[model samples]
Target: FLNKGFNVVDSSVATGKIEVSNAYKIADLTDAGAISVGKQLGAEVIVKGKALAKEGPRNTGSKVGSYIADITASALRVDNGAVLGSARGHGVSRNISEVTGGTEALEKAAREASGKIIDQIIAKWSGEVSGGGLIQLTVRGIGEYSDFVKFKDIIQGQIRGVQAIYQRSLEGGIAVLDVEMKGNAQQLSDEIARKNFGGIPVKVIGASANTVEVSLGGAVSAKTMSTPPSSPPAAQPSPPVPAAQETSSFFEADEYLVFSGDRDENGRVGKMVTRPTATNPEGEFLMYHDGQKVWSKFFKAVRSAAASELQLGSRIYFFEGNHKEGVYYSPKDKSEARLESWWRDPVTDNSLVNNRGIVTVGRYRVDVSNAFVEKK
Candidate 1:
């Protein structure tokens, strides 16, 4: 058996030379010893058999009968104390007077008994000991993005009795695998698709002669390993302003300052002339405009105009009315008009001025030609 490259264990041949080492264990036919030996040696089953040799009478021509050889063999399982199989054989010598040939007859009887016993045992255990073979696999043309170890583990877990021993690198990005097979290989290929590795699509690239060599090739799926979080909307650029509209010009007048005071510097210079000028409290000059004492109307119009222009910051001011009847000028437009109003030192309070007297008002306009101003 060893010369033919078959793994076989023989315990009776003590002087025989075999390449593989033999293991010897001392055990009796008792049930306890059989179970202990089975567990210790990691054997799935323990076989035990006995051979019995007997002498019987054979038919002769004249006398009743001469003595002949007989043998019986019985085999059983020691672990469970169950009778696994049994075989009995008998052999008779041609000459009854030949007592010296009894040894040869006994040996022949034993060999016949042993062969029958072995055949019975094998038939009983054939179902449990079949389909265990080695499977060699080769994987070729796998890209660097593929994780081979993880792929192997996935395949092994899905398939029954498939074990990846070791992977070796070959030329041109090829990998070889020594796998122990306990089942079919086609089932394993179907399982790989079901697992959906890395959420990417995959396909078998190539297969070797024994259907063991497998190659994978396909594009990665949209769902990658690392998923990104949802983000907020990005800021958009302001719309472009029409060039013709941007080139258009608009006139903007300064604030109108109106004041009422005594002309002769008298304690009671009643109802003097009133005038308006474009000026601030610090006497800074600006464009002047003449208008009625209607300060509220002018204030509303200028504010609305400035809002249409998209002005960010604008201001309006109220000053004392002039001594004139009902005329006003932009105080910020001229220096002499600002000094004339200051000399009266008139109380600029709105409540102090009567209906007949002109009141002062100041307002400013803004330019909205720029697109950036609308965005702000």
Candidate 2:
């Protein structure tokens, strides 16, 4: 597995004195038991299976030993206990010695099964990264609602290939956001450490395949980590503008974010930086036109009316809208995706539809027809 580029956990690590409630019986472990063991080993995916060797057809001429082995394996994502991929393989070997033949057959079967499992896992990873999959982001140490707001804006402003950010919940100073990005959690976590989010210090506490844990204001000490208040504070309203400033505020135009195209040697899209300076790192699937950044995936702000009606942990869908307006349509792909809520955009006339289970992230189409809540 290490030779195959996977970070494998040593078998010896689980050999003795391991902390699990299953009586340390590997053969009788259930899926939940396997997940607990994986968590102890700090593994993102755990591959576990059984192998069986049985008698095979004898040779015609010579009296030779024959054995056939069957191997089955599965790769599972530890965080959500999702079975990413699985495979089975069989091998046959003939030798004068029965034990040697059985051993060779078992080894061959294990090799074949591992190869198939690896291939399937890699294919699934590629499809998710390119198809705008959702990466679960957990931000801790966010005591202020404004900080939560700023964090969302920071993700929107800095990250590349991010179509939408769904606010899942805020509890105990931890905010859960489901971000749809054209990359994996590791890539997003790396980017979070590099950029500055309005002077807020952010740190990547932990990261898995599709989940990232972030800490605001750097690391939190055990003494400082306390229970949140019984009720969350309401978002503070913006201070009222003076009479003189109110008159001048109308002249300030809405400044849509803009960027310039950055491409690499193969013409693959690079990072879209605002200034394109040496300090700025390039992102993926981003292009700029008229100094305004146009992303391959973008989401409009959900109207206030729509957000108020949304219930926590309920899925929604969008089915109608004009190609023009805030919506961007692509001729090549016309799939309807769940557009994340943007905090900065103006409220429009878009409505909300009460539907679930139909979601397909398009490379270029923006679903402006409706707004809906996501179930955890």
Candidate 3:
């Protein structure tokens, strides 16, 4: 029966006497155990049987007795424990005295039992009662980038009842595509591996219920490190220097001086003084009462006062004179007319004044003796 491709699970006894050794092992069959084992083994049809034999009338002076054998077979669906069908076969042997022919009788009984089982199994399988299920196929591979979608369609077309869901991941510097099966996952997985669908190799990653996941590279890892860095370090700005406080006390009067001249020889007269002013043509002058210019001398005395304010070095400005509008003066013109013009206002027709100053000694102070003296 096994050679005939029929799975025969036997349990039979002949009239409480085992005609065949170890035949009782075949007799102890349970529907539950058979169904459980059959389902576990993926069997579509399960064959179970029972046999009975009794001695017939014995021939005169012969050591043989006529024997009648009855056999019953059943086919069941393992999936849902449904019985497909059942059949029984009965046969009588005329010569029952020969012990040598017992083997033949047993074989004949087994054959008859299996034939009945197979006939019922086939009849039910071909009938409307047989259940129909689907097998889905999944295919995946790696090659040309454009081939991913094409391969998926090809696999879906070649395998019936198969729906392909494609996914991609980068692994080992290669892009991998996974084709998942949506029906009869295991069957389709086996089919894909066997048929080599999509003209490329396929592998089964996992399967459950109606879905099977297939990956390229045949068991290759799907983990990828292809994502780029999310963020980068921000650039930093240079530190700033604390600005000096702009207070009058921070500046001294003497530091504002540019140049000093000698006093005249007469005690009543002094030498001409040239000093910087806060005006266009920046170095201007003031006439002193002693016939000595004291603007430069007065500025020299206060030169050290504004030393901290001379960031770009001392600038010389000529003082014109003190007025109600404030001190008027001019800037010392440089070779660059653009710089000179920047210090002068075109609209106001007035010179842009800076911080340097020129002062008249008699206007602020009364000291006139030895105020101007010529160098010996």
Query: Tens digit of lDDT per residue, candidate 1, span 275-322?
Result: 224552222221121111112111111211222332223222211112
- Candidate that would win on lDDT: 2
- Top candidate on TM-score is 2
Where is model 2 poorest over a 10-residue stretch in terms of lDDT? 262-271
Ranking the candidates on TM-score from highest down gives 2, 3, 1
**RMSD of model 3 against the true structure:** 53.2
Could you estimate the TM-score for every candidate? Answer: 0.24, 0.45, 0.29
CA shift at 90, candidate 3, in angstroms?
1.3
The lDDT for every candidate, in the order shown, is: 0.35, 0.53, 0.38
Which of the predicted structures, 2 or 3, would earn the higher lDDT when compared with the native? 2
- If both were scored by TM-score, which would come out higher, candidate 1 or candidate 3? 3
lDDT minimum window of 10 residues, candidate 1: 264-273
The stretch of ten residues in a row with the least summed lDDT in candidate 3 is 337-346
